[model samples]
Target: MDFYLVFTIFIFAGALIGSGLSFYVEYTKLEALESYFSENKVVCDNKRFWGRNTHIDRFYRMLLISQLLAMPKTHIKRGDVTEAELAAIPLSLKRWALWPINFGFIWFASIIIWNVWYR
Candidate 1:
């Protein structure tokens, strides 16, 4: 196969895996995260804004948690997440919430780069 075709296939597989992991986190761990952050007004308000669509709500929640894990200081300064609350979260949960989103972001950027470079 051509190198571009092979690389594109790899990117597609990575994106699929990232999406699946994202879905898994949303289904299994999202509720716990929601409860933990229930008192955070910013998170609650965003959740409420996406309340009309459960899928979007869950996706947003995943993204929020990922952001919270990736940049605790920023969210802390913004009052979106507290340090104590962030410390209380399990490391495994944090990893689960973080990696897939990171992978998705990388995968997206790769696709954009590939298109721009190869087109």
Candidate 2:
């Protein structure tokens, strides 16, 4: 049961990190989209390649997911994260802006309780 609890925490943390990484990747996409929109301004064309994924990008994205999934459990728990109390540091860096720690809390608790109590 304790193993399940720990495993739940591990999976939840992996999910949180995965989500944060994906969100950051998507933010980069949004920045590119904004740049394109600003430069083109609805220029009339027939090539509608919206939301299309390039081969290399998809490959790397899959690689990232696989790499994260394969990462050792100890590394994440011991990973060095930036949680400094400085005036110049941005809130996004000082805090887990993309996927905060509470996600791990709720995710693990829900999974553990559901499995232990209901299963």
Candidate 3:
């Protein structure tokens, strides 16, 4: 096998592992929040899940979700998001954003690095 092929495979594997670990961590937080919300009888406003603006800014949503999980009080103070949005973050949109985006970023970065350093 060619060295570059092997190196590329290794880089891809590392990127996949990193993405999996990252998603796993995020899923855990989502689950924890779900449990907490359930236990506390916190009712999320489901209507606001899609958000206030008609425009769907996925990047902003992702950042808002992270902020919601990491700094709930502070993020909530902004008053643009709701618990439903936080909870919905792990659903379809999130899966789309996390895996593909991370993989693409890593793949491109690795290819660029390889070209610059090896080629």
Leading candidate by lDDT: 1
Model 2 C-alpha RMSD vs. true structure (Å) is 12.9
Q: What is the lDDT of candidate 3?
A: 0.53
Residue-wise C-alpha lDDT for candidate 1, range 3-97, written one tens digit per residue:
88888888888878887888888889888877878788877887887776477778986777778889999888887788988888888877877
**Cα lDDT tens digits for candidate 2, 1-119:** 68667776677677767667655644444333223223222211211333345644433433332232234253245441111212233444323322333455566677777677647
- What would the TM-score be for candidate 2 when compared with the true structure? 0.29
Ranked candidates (lDDT, high to low): 1, 3, 2
Candidate 1 Cα misplacement greater than 4 A, ranges: none
Instruction: Kindly list the per-residue Cα lDDT of model 3 for residues 19-63, writing each as its tens digit.
Output: 675555444444443343342222233223634433343234343
Top candidate on TM-score is 1
Clashes of each: 0, 0, 0
Better by TM-score, candidate 2 or 1: 1
* lDDT of candidate model 1 versus the reference: 0.82
Superposed Cα RMSD, model 1 = 1.8
Task: Give the number of colliding residue pairs in candidate 2.
Answer: 0
